[model samples]
Target chain A: MDTHAAYKSRWLPWVLLLPSFVILLVFLYYPTIETFVLSLFQVAFLGLSKSFVGLENYKILFTDPDYRQIFKNTVVFAFFVVIFSMAVGLALSVLANQRVTGWRIYRLLLIWPYALSPAVAGVIFLFMFNPQSGIVNYLLEISLGVAPDWLTNPTLAMALLVFVAVWKNVGYNVVFYIAGLQNLPGEVLEAALIDGATPWQRFWRVTFPLLSPMTFFLLIINTIYAFFEAFPFVDLLTKGGPSNATNILIFNIYRDGFEYYKTGMAAAQSVILFIAVVFLTILQFRLGEGRVHYGG
Target chain B: MKRLVTVIGLSALLGFAFAAEKVQITFWHAFGGGRTAFIQRAVEDFNYTHPGIEVKVEYKGSYRDTLNAAILAAKQGNAPHIVQIFEVGSQLAIDSGIFVPIQDFVPAGLEFQLDDYIKPVANYYRIGGKFNSIPWNSSNPILYYNKDIFKKAGLDPNNPPKTYNEVVQACEKIIASKAAPKCITWPLHSWFVEQWIAEQGALLANNENGRAARATDVYINSEAMKRIMKWWKGLYDKGYYAYTGKPEDWDGANQLFVSKQAAMEITSTSDVTFMQNASFENGFELGTGFLPTADGVERNGTVVGGASLWLTKGHPQKEQEAALTFLLWFTNTENMVRWHKGTGYFPVLNTSVKVLEWQHWFERNPAYRAAFDQLLQSKANRATQGALIGPFPEVRTIIENMIQEIFQGKDLAKALAEADAKADQALKRYNASVKK
Candidate 1:
């Protein structure tokens, strides 16, 4: 078979791609452009009224202390979630990859958290960490003679959100890493072993470098997850509460748009969040392009 | 086989004809759990009794979600015939221009008994001397205390705290006696602040609580709010207040009280039935009282905090009429009594209250008496009617977050100032957008 089919008509190729392009235009491009335009206006009464105010919405975002705090919270939350999930995911994947008798069961158990939606996970954690009657507090009171307020305390709330996000996302990361581990050229690691390299050195100098491509891919996936997919956890658990301590950007957008009916402000927030994730992803790619060691 | 097929086809045709003859109207409400079941039962009764109208009831997620869904659906020209909007969303609902004031649907000289409705509730939903929506489920906050804890602390179980000083004194004895881990708890909700401000006979916003004009400023930083916050902060500082740490965590507060972790909780009267069940389940005696007010301030009564049913515009005349019929029947005296008995919400009809009193309903459910007495004792004022603001939900969230910040050691003055600024900004944007 020919490596590439040479179409005789240029319009034919365009026509063939029309379906996907149209879908992207309708679902992706139109909404993004609409959100950008809507962000310039002050929308009221669930968009029964709208008046353009130029960059007033964006200016508010820049000047508003609450929005600034949310932005900082998002960054901090994303950083911790990405780092911890990836590290824990890699460790778990390595263990699951071992040729132990119950390795299948271990993998299945480790991957079950990924099957639960963020909202469900949030609900589970919410009951467990409830300050009044949650099992966590009940157990702590029994053992430590002190029960910390889990959902209400600002620091603890944020920490709990990060913890839940990492716990939910680690399974996803582990799945990818396991596939990456199975695909790694065993000969390279074996050569390192034969050349008198220690197990740790073999991992860092050979196996780790070989898995860079997977790591790069996981980095982008985890960052996007942290940015957007972490919303439900915050919503179900904290509701961006206890003084906006755990209020991430996405949750703030939801509150403004859906709860408060401040569509224009929420649209403005959406644009900012979009730009932030795009910039972060681009930065990840630029950095990864230099370091990712793709094997021949 | 041919005979069976013929019979099935005929029945299908008949079913379609039957469904088409009825004026179908959809009703979206914000009730969940057992209350949803109660609403379903009422709607079924309505459907069963009114054969010409098929009232389809839907359980929308929450008051905010229901209102938003209605507005969005209205924009799409698929709005339900009726939507239950919280009292705080009254201004927004009216300003949306998508709802037909229920008064418009009232036939002239029909003896609709509009005047028979309770003053506070009617006042809350009525704008410009006309009811914008039919007041349905209405509630006010009341104090729920564990009588056993009160007795354990040597405080009179029957007589609950009525003022901030009395609450603090009670808390002192309760804490000193170690009856419970905390003395009191309430959802860190802005509703309480609004109620307390009303209790002090202070308006939450200018222009007669936005009844005279569109609200442009919020009184979050006013002296009235300061007094409320100071008292609240004092309890927090003294470690007598149980801080659930979440904003608007009504269930958490309820748990703290029901589980005997806290001796008292101030929550909505709608939770009266829940409290009764919880006290039974948790093996405690529940006592109810009027929500405590600031010291030395004459109580002005709490505002109505539940929702009302609004008729959406753009429906067919038949559907609209059917929706009006459903709304009227849903809030009629008989149904109101049933609603009150089923849920702890106020029976918003004077006739319903009369019937309940005549029936001696309150004697059996004495805990409900506290809520009813509080509502009756409330003076009809702009504050008690509650503030009408376009951005009420946002302003509430800000106030709640501010309270949380203050609880976490943020300077009270700074938190109030910040909350006031944010609330005013929201009001400005809302007013501007609606003005255009």
Candidate 2:
């Protein structure tokens, strides 16, 4: 009877998990496996005829300078986006947590950018930074006596893209940070304050340490978001433009796959990107284990 | 009593069986807005005239999107009976082997009087002396200028810039007079670029812009192209031009023109309706002119920019016949005249032009005659023929990138050379893959 009961309990958990398991297998694993298979062959709109060209697509991707530059650009874009987003999100969350007047309104205004679609945000940025007639340039010229071609300048274009990405995404991180801040034990902060710790001292020594788990979570999530989610803005605003300065890995993958119809090459590039993201994520987790505090 | 009831039922069934089969043919097109209404009207008329057949038309987004969707669907065995592929995609569609030749559907030995079609327009759809698809709603790029802006800039409103030098001079005057922020605007489209190259009688690609056959090489970095790029670069350097950055940013340029902020704009003749309907603050009148030419170079004809109706394979003989009948009706003279008058597209049938002339429509709307006259007067040269590159959409993106580079102050010659190298590599790969 006990063995039967144990078996029933074991099957019950699986039965409860069955729906999610099937959903993941169908939606995620199936497409991933198909994409992997497609990567081994040359596919087009005409028809799919597979011929074994083992590692040939990978060779082409690795040998191409454009792909290398695109990889570097993507890494750079992601790094800047994550760093800027975390900094801004943390600051905004901390400020909102303070018992200031109308703090809720400020918080609402701060996180409002997260509500915008990336494509719409990209258009708004494009108009705001347009060289000829953008409001940003107009303001800059009138106040600072300088108006640079923000989109046309290769050096500034990527920076502008990172700025836009952070502006649009930092609000999402702020929500996470605010939750982390609110969930913190009040006794720990009160104890630190009673022990002659100042506000900055308490934040740096106690509060920041307690928020390490949240910081780690935000880091991983923001990195992935920067890698994949920020690509549409780059496509819409710059089109990997100003002499391919803004071309990132996923954008290059899209250009090669859909626009150029170089399916195998794009798949190979995607595999590379996947491997890189996995490696970075593992490294982040490994590094954060020593620093992250799970409890007060 | 049973026998009497059975006899009555059998007679009723026989009477119902004698009724015609409701033939349904699916037509996928990229037409929307006013053009969609015109096509819907044509479908309604065709259905009314032919009691047995019903044509179902579906709007499938832009020309490129429609072609991509149809090609994908054809591979999956779900393609429509008829698809409206753009002119550039015609070669790709023909090479794909999924479409049934229109000539094959028509009765054998029944000459369709192919000579009735305008030579250049019909020749575009012809592959080795056999027409592949029926050309419909064809248009060419033309210059659209604001007369009020021209007057303010001290330029002749009637006689717009004819030569490239004159265009530059007029742009400068317009800018200097503060009539417009930028004197002129050109939408960044490959078709328009090809048209400009053809206007200078420069070959865009080998093999007669690939009309003779499929192109394996791109001549985008030729001397004439370099010259044109240099001229555009000069204009950009002088602040007489502005790049909208987005390929679909013609709305901004149109707004600029309508607001009397831009003196001149070059776009498709199809944009005539949009320009005509735009509410202008200063009440500007539009001036239509032929595309400008370089000094001492005659203007070559602009290539067709609209979509054509393609018949897909894998349909019953009756359905095929019904599709062909629909195509014939869609391109008939009266239908063509109605389509042309309704949309800004020039009628594909010469008889439709004659009919319009008889009706005094062209006399009342003289601006609409500019594209027709320009096309008719153009010499049938290889340069003026359209590009038929296999991976043309990809090639266009590459060219757009090169243009962006130029806008960023890259050396035009070097940039074009690099772009040419990349495009040739792409062409070679595309040609090899498409090879039987």
TM-score, prediction 2: 0.92
Best by DockQ: 1
Q: Fnat of the models, one by one?
A: 0.79, 0.29
Candidate 1 Cα deviation (angstroms), residue B250: 1.5
Docking class of 1: medium
- The lDDT of model 1 is 0.89
> How many pairs of residues collide in each model?
1, 0
lDDT per residue as tens, model 1, A78-171: 9999999999999899889999998999999999999997788987898788876789888999999888988768888999999999999889
- Residue B72 of model 1 has an lDDT of 88
| lDDT digits (tens) for residues B112-201 of candidate 2 | 545567876876677666778888878887888888888988889998987778889998888888988888777555666778787778
Question: For each candidate, what is the lDDT?
Answer: 0.89, 0.80
What docking grade does candidate 2 earn? acceptable
